[model samples]
Target: MFRYYFLVIYTVYMLLKHIKLLYELQTLDPRLSYAKQMEAVYDKPKSFMRGCIGLTGSTVSIHQFGKTPKGPVLYVHPKLKLADLAVLLGHLDKTPSFFAEPRAFRYPLVHQWLNKMGAIKKNGGEHTAVEQIEEIVRKGQSFILSEADGIDYESLSSRLGVPIVPIETSGIEDMQKGSFFKRLKPADLDLTIHRAYLPENKRLRA
Candidate 1:
């Protein structure tokens, strides 16, 4: 009786191991419809933009800014405008938006805000800053208009070999409105704020 019982337990253990192996094989099979469905669900989008916000002390309000397929997008606080936020969120394929370091003059307040939003880290060494920007650019991204002028933008554009578009925010009124769901139209200001930063190749292409 004891010998018979031992044989049955051993057989059951082997059978269970084989069943587990079969389940794993089914999961690993690419041709399986379930596997294909999983891939489709997790696939990344092709065209995505990197959004940035630049805050100035003189302005007293933060700006929502980013680059788009056509060019740059500049407005006020995104969360304050439901329509604009919807437009931005719709455009996000799979890429992320990053707010780079604000100017040194407004470091204290800006840094605190960024920390709360988890947008950026405190300013590290020069080498680290370069590495951060390079990594973001390599991932096919662009920054929104903060203090990015001609020279700073030119340096970044040359290093990344990508065009840096500056979204102009001079003429966008109603940005200081009360409701967070306000409507916004494109401003009619001169859009050539960082024209000098554009590369020769990009200019020729344009």
Candidate 2:
């Protein structure tokens, strides 16, 4: 019985140790820089312009949506080609902003896409997504990208005066379908829980 109890305790301790390691790795992810940049632009006032919003789906679906009256007249479809996104980013002459969400930094793939982009100064405060959108527009931001799959395009379009375009990518829709808790596997939850214990950093890396 003692031996069995010792084994159980050892297992639990190892599991916790694994969780700590994962949290550390997540904090070190380079994409966190991108997330911070996005946050900065969303919250602050700066000279931004030509702000466009995009909703991604399958490439074929985007084409079909574009035909309708509600479809965006113009957009960029990266189609999971980071190079394409990079080119579009270059053309913008500024880093695009992102909708506020924890997954923006926590998810590597999404952050990888947004990393190293530009960011405006921060206004600082808890703001709703709609409010952030308005703030970004007021500051003259050119584009705002939603978290991969969490935003309600219809609700946002109805609330805002700007046009919300559908820009289809090959795999992004599926990739971010469950970016947060709903998507996490049982084994991954421990790391997420551990992340919450870390001190939050409000000021983004420059």
Q: Pick the candidate with the highest lDDT.
A: 1
Q: On residues 131-160, what C-alpha lDDT tens digit does candidate 1 reach at each position?
A: 665665564433332443112555666766
For residue 65, what is the lDDT in candidate 2?
A: 24
Report clash pairs, candidate 1: 54-146
Candidate 1 residue runs with Cα over 4 Å from true position: 1-96, 100-118, 125-127, 148-151, 170-173, 177-204
Which candidate achieves the best TM-score against the true structure? 1
lDDT (C-alpha, whole model) for all candidates: 0.35, 0.33
RMSD of 2: 17.7
What RMSD, rounded to one decimal, does every model reach?
19.8, 17.7
Residue 199, model 2: Cα distance from true site in angstroms: 40
Return the clash pairs for model 2, or none. 48-140, 48-141, 49-140, 50-142, 51-142
The TM-scores of all predictions, comma-separated, are 0.35, 0.29
